[model samples]
Target: MRDAFVRALLREMARDERIVLVTGDLGFGVLRPVKEQFPDRLLNAGIAEQSMVGLAAGLAATGRKVVVYSIGNFPTLRPLEQIRNDCAYHGADVKIVCVGGGFVYGSLGMSHHATEDMAVLRAIPGVTCFTPGDPAETEAVVPAMFQTPGTCYLRLGRGNEPHAHEEPVPDWRFPKAIRLREGRDIALLSAGGILVELKRAAEKLAEAGVSAEVVSFPCLKPLDREAVLSLAGRFTDLITVEEHTILGGFGGAVCEVIAEAGCPCRVHRLGLKDEFSAVVGNQAYLRHLYGIDGEAIAEKAMALINEKRTDAGRNP
Candidate 1:
């Protein structure tokens, strides 16, 4: 996903000379091509995330489309104040790009985990949040973020994430949920790179005779309310999966819409249960430990379906 973001960013930079990239002293290998092509446009802030954001905001104020690049919490949590005050407050065209959204840096430990980025960034007013689920979604989202007029937060996975969309999402618009597969039993809605696991879970559910619909939400803040409501009306069960905490993250966002609309759909959120990760290894290991992997998602979906069946039998 990081590679796809850079590729898309490169294309955008070529078209618009006003675009400048500021990094927090990382991503040298991945961003090398960017530095080589646009030598004058890239700047390194030497691990000072706050200054990086402030610089980006200043650049944006000077009529430059500035993108602050970093990994995990450095770009979001570390310099959140600068983002809120300097960028969002002034409606600066600053694109804050985070390379590792969830446990992409799990091996480094909990400090690097971006478990609450979506929720944190979404709370700030006038900040657009983009949590692309795969390289394809990342590719589609980068241009939209640049085209957007105000401050935007882009949460991306590390490189080599499996593509969820079979074909290019050429028609994808900002803040709209894309339905990857159609089903009837339940709907599996995912935000971020976990869409790959959701897709696998859908297949597993299908094998067990539970038809599951898969939807990817690339933009989280201005969530696709129409799509969420449509799914709520169509399906009795809606499961929201994210790599972040369930409390105020993707699941919380979905629940907010459903509850306010008085929708009868039962939402089962699959994510971190309001706690930080205690153990760490690789991304896959942590996902399994937290019970947000493909197998766990499949099992949870089946349990939800069975519970509904049991309830209907008892009522009838």
Candidate 2:
């Protein structure tokens, strides 16, 4: 996903010379192409995330489209004040990009985990949040963020994420939900890197005679309400999956839309249960431990389907 973001960013930089990239003294290998092609446009802020964001905001004020890049919490959480005050307040064209969201940096321990990024960034007014599920979605989101005229937050995974969409998304628009598979039983909505797990879960459910629809929400804030309402009308059970905490993240966002509309669809959120990850390992290992992996998602979906069946039998 990181590679895809850079590739898209490179294309955008070539098309528009107003774009500038500022890094927090990291992502050297993955961002090599950008440095080589546009050396004058790339600046390293030397690990000072707050100053880096402030600098980017200043550049944006001076008619430059500035993008601040870093891994984990450095870009978002560490310099949130600067993002809120300097960038969003002034409506600066600053795109804050955070790589290694969720447990992508699990081996480094809890400090690097970006579990609450979406929720936190979404709460700030005038800040657009993009949580692309795969490389394809990442490719689609980069250009949209640059085209947007205010502060934006982009949450990305570490490199090597499997593509959920086989081909490039056509007629892609901001905050629109992309339905990858059509099904009747339930709708499996996912944000961020967890879409791969939900896609696998849907396949597993299909083998078990349970059909599951897979939808990827590349943009979290300004969620596709029309799509959510349409799914609610068709399916009785809706599950939201995300790599971040369930509290005020993807799951919370979906629930807000459903409840306000008085939709009867039951939403079961699958994510971190309002707690930090205490264990450290690879991304897969931590997902399994937190019960947000493919196998777990499949099991939960089956249980929900059966529960509904039993309830209908008793009521009838």
Task: Quote the positional error of residue 296 for candidate 1 in Å.
Answer: 0.6
lDDT by residue (82-135, candidate 2, tens digit) is 999999999999999999989999999999999999999999999999989999
For residues 46-115, could you state the per-residue lDDT of candidate 1 as single tens digits? 9889888998999999999999999999999999999999999999999999989989999999998999
TM-score of each: 0.98, 0.99
Predicted candidate 1, C-alpha RMSD = 0.8
lDDT of 2 at 50: 93
- Candidate 2 lDDT score relative to the true structure: 0.93
The per-candidate count of clashes, in order, stands at 0, 0
Q: Provide the overall lDDT of each model, using Cα atoms, as 2-decimal numbers.
A: 0.93, 0.93
